[model samples]
Target chain A: MRIFFYSVQSEWLKTKNSIASWLCLVGGFFIPLLYLIADIKNKTFINSAGTEIWQTHFTRLWMNMSGFLLPMGLILASSLITQVEFKNNSWKQVHVTPQKYSTIFFAKLAVLLGMTLKFFLFFNIGVIIAGTVPCLIFDHSFPKENIPWLYFIEKNARYFIACLPIIALQYLLSLQFKNFVIAVGVGLAGLIGTFIAFRWQYIYLSPFSYTNPFAERSGFSENILLYATIYFVVFTIISFYLYVNKKIKG
Target chain B: MEYCVQTTDLAYTFSNRQQVLDNVSIHVPEQCIYGFLGPNGAGKTTTLKLILGLLRNHQGTIKIFNKPIAGHRVEIMRSVGSLIESPSVYGHLSAKDNLRIFQKVYQCPQGRIDEVLSMTGLANTGTKKAAQFSLGMKQRLGIAIALLHHPALLILDEPTNGLDPNGMVEIREFLKLLNREHGTTILISSHLLTEIDRLATHIGLINKGRILFEGTAEQLKKEKNRETYILYKTSDNQAAAALFARQNIKPALLPDTIKIAATSKENVAGLNRLLVHNGLDVYEITTEKNDLETIFMNLITD
Candidate 1:
């Protein structure tokens, strides 16, 4: 337990020095700011298109950022965390220490998860700031009736929960490849491939499609969750296994 | 006498079908500086990894402080500090903070952080991030981390690979202090023969994954003297040759010099005086002793 906390703290210190964290936070804010400007210019036309248009637009933006942008951020963060060890030749140093494999593994995992949460915070802050400008300029009543605070929380919660599996996948891929570009490339391919596969009528079978926060389902069916759950568990197991059993060869 | 580390018939082969270590055995005595000497691709690093339990699927048993390393890995690891190749420092953290993290990992006293920092000469660099450190400073920080827990043994692989002469001296002195004061047994690997010759009490010379020689520095020096040669420069080289012939020395003459094998240092002076007394102007007499380079060359050639 002490070692675990130490690993997490050390990883957190490393995360603060990373460029990916800054890029994700800044990029997330920039994208929402552009969307707000477009919304303000077409406010009159958008209001005439009814409340469903606003819902669809908001949902689509949130889904696109959560499913694509957020995962990309984590992919970069995960790659940086793992690649630092390889580039600096620190794995051999750490492996011979008293710290156990599980401690180091989870410490890195905590950093990845923490980075993901920070991205969400930055995304929501951007949304709130962007929403404020239109709310005052267009004399909009804040859309409280159509989009309740509880609904906002529910949507964000689901988006965050759905990211857990991707986080695990990215961690595994990053640990497997000591190169940043290769890990990020494989992550981008997996994200784009799954997104394209979900466009077919067999979307129910696709794990990426289930990432839809607004989908009208209480709980996932055993089959759909099984696909993701199996992958999540397997990747996590293999990541830890390889880490513990890996030979320290330069 | 307790053995800090012992390996029996250890072997490892990489996935690319390259045999890195073949039937290598090492014995590191407690409170001694055991130098692992080898050329590049000689499996020095591979042997260290196998002893540290970093690599599995080996053919032999490794016992650290007399306990098998397989089941008691964590217990054994806690009492060992290692700098395998480079310092495993988080470049972003301050030098002090890096030590603090390892302090927590090993659950050692906080005061040891300062102790190790001062030991490594990083005490004045407090609050300075490790990223700004030079390669030698980074190596010191690595040694600091290894010393944090006050382990019974410290393992270092090529610890002086990239240091300047001053930095090398600092690390060498620091290791000596650790061994003399703290009684920390050390197992260090290096390809530099002179450095190992100066610091090591016992050496294991490895070549092609096999230990070519394992003994004390004195023993190696003795082995070197057995193959010593005497170079004699004389005015009457032919007369000196006849003198050696009369004495049944069988000297080989080349130009103005005669070469003769001498088993002891006393024999070189004896032969020089004999040549000078025999109507020969002995200008110079030099004895060439075998060194690591010669030993390594002989091992490889044979």
Candidate 2:
């Protein structure tokens, strides 16, 4: 257990030192800043818009930001965590340790998951800032009907839960490829490919398309939750199996 | 006494279908600096990997500390430290931070980080990242990491590959200190004959994935008897050989001189007296001992 914590701490330290983390922070703030300016201008154009307009704008901004940013954040985190070992050819160093493989594997997984949570935290703050601007600039009263704080919590929880599989898949992909570019490229290509496949409506069976669970008002369907749970469990098992069996050569 | 590492009929083939290691067996005695001497592509690194369990698909048995490497791998590996090929370090982390990270892996006390730092002479470069370190410093850091856990066995492959002469001497002295003080069983592989000759007590000379010879340096040196040669500028060469033959001594004939294998300095003087008595003038006499390079060359060439 101590080994696990130490590995996790090391992974977290690397994430903190990464250039990708700075880019995520800058990009996170920029996205919400742009949306807030656009929403303020949109409110000024309307003659009689109420709190409902502001609430809808807030939900849309949060959803859109998370839809794009969270996956990218996961990709960055996964790539960063795996790239450190790959770049320095330190896999042999880690493997020769007395720590169990599961402990090391989960430590990296935890860091990737934690970074994704951090993105959500920053994005939430951005959402609040974006929501506040329209009310201050246009003297618009916030819509109480769309401000379902409990629903917002439940929906974000489902969204975060849905992202677990992508985190696992990204970790696996990054581990499979020593090059960060290949990992990130494959992740982006996967995201785009899944989005395109979802549009065609032919491969609804694909799990990547279901990465975003709270996009609509489905209110966390039992079916989607079940599928996501199975997907998460299956991919987690497969990724760890491959990692444990992978040959460590310097 | 039990061996620190023992292998039986080990073989490994890479993905390119090239046999890197054939059926080779090696025995490393406990607390001895076993020099794994071989040329490039002689399967030294591959053998180390097999012993460390870093590479699988090997058809053989490997036992370290009397434990089967495959069954009790973690338990056995915990007591072993290795620096294979190059130093494995996080280039972005400071020297201190790198030690701290490995300390966690070894589950050692925090003080060990400082201990290894001082031991490897990296104590003064606390804040310097590994990328900024010189090759010798990095090699020291690598040794520091290998020693961090207080491992009983250290397996280093070409530890002095890229270091300068001073660095090599420093490492050699340090390794000697480690062995003398801590009794750490070191198995170091290198092609540098002089370094191994100076350091290793027992050497396993390998060639083409096979053990050519295994013995102490003295034993190898003793394998060939020291032959003495006499450079006699004699008046008649054939008469000199005829005289030695009549005296029951076989003198080897060279282009310019006749050589005789004298047993000792006294024997050389005795032979000179006999040659002078027989009317042969001896101008110069030379003798050479079998050094490691000559012995190694003889072993490989033969």
Candidate 3:
């Protein structure tokens, strides 16, 4: 366990100056900053609809985010973070370390998950800033209801869960292929294919279709999260098998 | 003798069914500088990779510290540090940052980072990203990381490939110091005979997916000295040859020189005196012995 923790820490350090780090900070802030600008310019806070204003703010944020940016951000972030080893030609070094192959595999996957969570943290903070800044700028009467903290947290957690299959699949692709374009290309094509088949009766078969349904609160089975969980587990198992049994890692 | 690293009949074939190593076995004695010498594509790097557990599914077993490497790889690797083929370095990180990452992984003392940096002559490279470093500097940084944990066995494959002569000398000296003072066993590989000849106490020479020689450097020297000859440049080559012929010594005549297989140092001296007594100007009488390069060629061709 100590070795595993150390592996995770070391893996995190490799993310320094990588494109994944930039994508996290920028991906998190881009939507909120755009919303803040639009809201401050339009002065929508002056005609607030009580508690619904908070719901409206979060809904719009998730709508724009979950439909496109969230899945794409995960694909790019996971690939970039995983590719750090390949790009630096340091996979041989990583493999030669005293850690178990399982530890190395999971430690990197954990770091990628942590990066996603950091992206969420930054994006949520941005959401708050976007929500409050317009009211502050125009000095309009603030919304008359308390923030729905529990509701927003629940939605964010669910959306994060929904995006897991994408992360796992992309992680697998990046680990198997040294070329960045192939990993990113396969992920983008999968997401685009999900979008094209979104209206199918059995669209729930695809994990990528979950985030949009969960965000819009429509077009999904009640077992949607369960299906996402199953896909995440299946992909993760396949990834673990490939990584540990890999004959030539470095 | 207790060996630090032992491989028995280790063989490997690539995915394409191209065999890279064949029945290659090497024994690196504890606390000795074991040089792995071979030409390019001589399976040197492949053998090193197999020993390090970077390449798996081989036909033989590797034992480090007398324990099988299959089940105890991580435990064995804790005491082993390696730099295989090229220097494995993260280009964007500074030397200090790079070492710090490995330090956390190895869970070694933070002070050891500075220790290895200065040891590899990279302590002055503060805040300079490794990507901007010269090739030699990056190679040094790679070596520093390998040495960071103070492992008992250091496996380096062509560690001197990119270094300037001065850098190479420093690394050679540092490796020697590491082995002598710390009792660390080293298995260094190189294609150049002179490179290994200066440093190796023991050598394992490989070529064409096979090990041709494995023994002490002195034993390799004996093999090189098997065929010794003498060359003579005189004021009169014909006169020197005529003198040798008269003395019942067959000399191979060349352009302005006479060559003969040397039987003993005393006989060479006697021949020189005979030339001088015969009123011939023996401008040069040079005894020649085969070097490791020639020995390597002979081994390969054989």
Each candidate's interface RMSD (Å, one decimal) is 2.4, 2.0, 0.9
- The residue-by-residue lDDT of candidate 2 on B68-98, one tens digit each, is 8887887887899999888888888887888
Task: Tell me the lDDT of candidate 1.
Answer: 0.77
For each candidate in turn, the TM-score is 0.83, 0.82, 0.91
lDDT (C-alpha, whole model) for all candidates: 0.77, 0.77, 0.88
Q: In candidate 1, which residue ranges exceed 4 Å CA deviation? A: A35-61, A133-149, A203-227, A248-250, B126-128, B232-259, B263-285, B290-302
Query: Please, what are the lDDT tens digits per residue for candidate 3 over residues A1-250?
Result: 9888999999899888778998999999999999888887877762374557777888878789888898999999989987888887899998889999899989999999899899999998998889888888888766676778998889888888888999999999999999999999998988899888787778788868887744245556577778889999999999999988889967
**Docking quality class, candidate 2:** acceptable
Q: Which candidate tops lDDT?
A: 3
Question: Could you give the candidate ranking by lDDT, starting with the highest?
Answer: 3, 2, 1
The sequence of per-residue lDDT tens digits that candidate 1 reaches over residues A72-97 is 67667778777777776777766776
Tell me the tens digit of each residue's lDDT in model 1 across B133-191.
Answer: 99899988998888888888999999987789988998998888889998999999999
Q: Distance from true position, residue B45, model 3, in Å?
A: 0.7
Q: What shift in Å separates residue B131 of candidate 1 from its native position after superposition?
A: 3.1
**Candidate 2's error at B251, in angstroms?**
13
RMSD of candidate 3 to the true fold?
Answer: 3.8
Candidate 3 lDDT, tens digit per residue, B34-139? 9999989999999999989898899998999999988898999899999987787888889998998899999999999999999999999999889899989989
Which TM-score does chain B of candidate 1 obtain?
Answer: 0.82
